[model samples]
Target: MKKSIYAAMLSGIVCPGSGQIWLGKKLLGWGFISVSVVCILVIMDQIISRAQVIAEQILAGNIGNDLTSIYAAVSNVALDASNSTMPALTWIFIVNWGLSVASAFWFGAQQDKQLQLQADSKTEA
Candidate 1:
């Protein structure tokens, strides 16, 4: 029920930086979102490029048109490290998400503490 919990869940389950946005930290949230989006785009670009290569092979008759042949080609392409930058991108994406979640939770907790202090001061007055 705490804002910190909600913020963390938003970032972890919804998307990176979503929690920061919920916590009114627009700039930080956007930074996390931008990094995540860029990583995703780059990864997708690599995948599409590999798909194109497979398609070309199919067209050139080097790969069969059957489902099994297509699967084999896809597997080969995915495992071909020389043709992909996915390994590093995947790690970056994961680390970004983790940082976003942690920051959102920390910011949310800080906000909650401030609110509590304000409330206590008002009660003392």
Candidate 2:
């Protein structure tokens, strides 16, 4: 059980679904991995778009054509990007990854316990 848990946790480090795979839960692991990948890609796209918008704004002189305005605009972009994608997606990834590892461990442990109980019952019988 410990070995399974360790493997699952290790897999999570590589990708969210990896740990689930280690525990023989291929479908669950794949689901988690797919969701994580999609969320990450979406986050990246949003960040890139925000950066491009900021750049265009700078180029267009809409930010006062001054260093201070440029700095402020950059900061605003950073904040917006963080709010738009980073925080929410990061939380989702973390939760899914954690759940995958925890589920793998719990499943393995429960199976082991059940087998042990069955063996004890047979011995007693």
Candidate 3:
């Protein structure tokens, strides 16, 4: 397979920035990795905190232990407007993944072109 295609696939399938790392773009790859990690951490923290709150309510008898009650609590948490960070983090993670894929493909294609040029020059000489 072409390096560009492979790199793009790796980035998309594995983790964002993995393709860039495969393409020897350590700085760019690490940058994407860091952003992705931060987004993931923040989103997870928000979700876990909400879950803990619901669990506490259930234990305290504020919320019933029934499935319906649990579902409603989850729904309320999902629709909560005060926690807008989750949506923003999700979008940022998605955008970062896309950018990493594109960057890996572009850099790989450039490398391929350079190699082709070198091969052509050698053949001429």
Q: Evaluated with lDDT, which candidate comes out highest?
A: 1
Q: What TM-score does structure 3 among the candidates reach?
A: 0.95
How many steric overlaps are in each model, in order? 0, 0, 0
TM per candidate comes to: 0.94, 0.70, 0.95
Residue lDDT tens for model 3, 56-95:
9999999999999999999998998987788889999999
Query: lDDT values of the candidates?
Result: 0.93, 0.77, 0.92
Which residue segments of model 3 deviate by more than 4 Å? none
Q: Write the per-residue lDDT of candidate 2 for residues 58-98, one digit (tens) a residue.
A: 78877677878878887877766436457878899889888
Stronger candidate by lDDT (2 vs 3): 3
Best by TM-score: 3
Rank order by TM-score, top first? 3, 1, 2
Choose 2 or 3, whichever is better by TM-score. 3
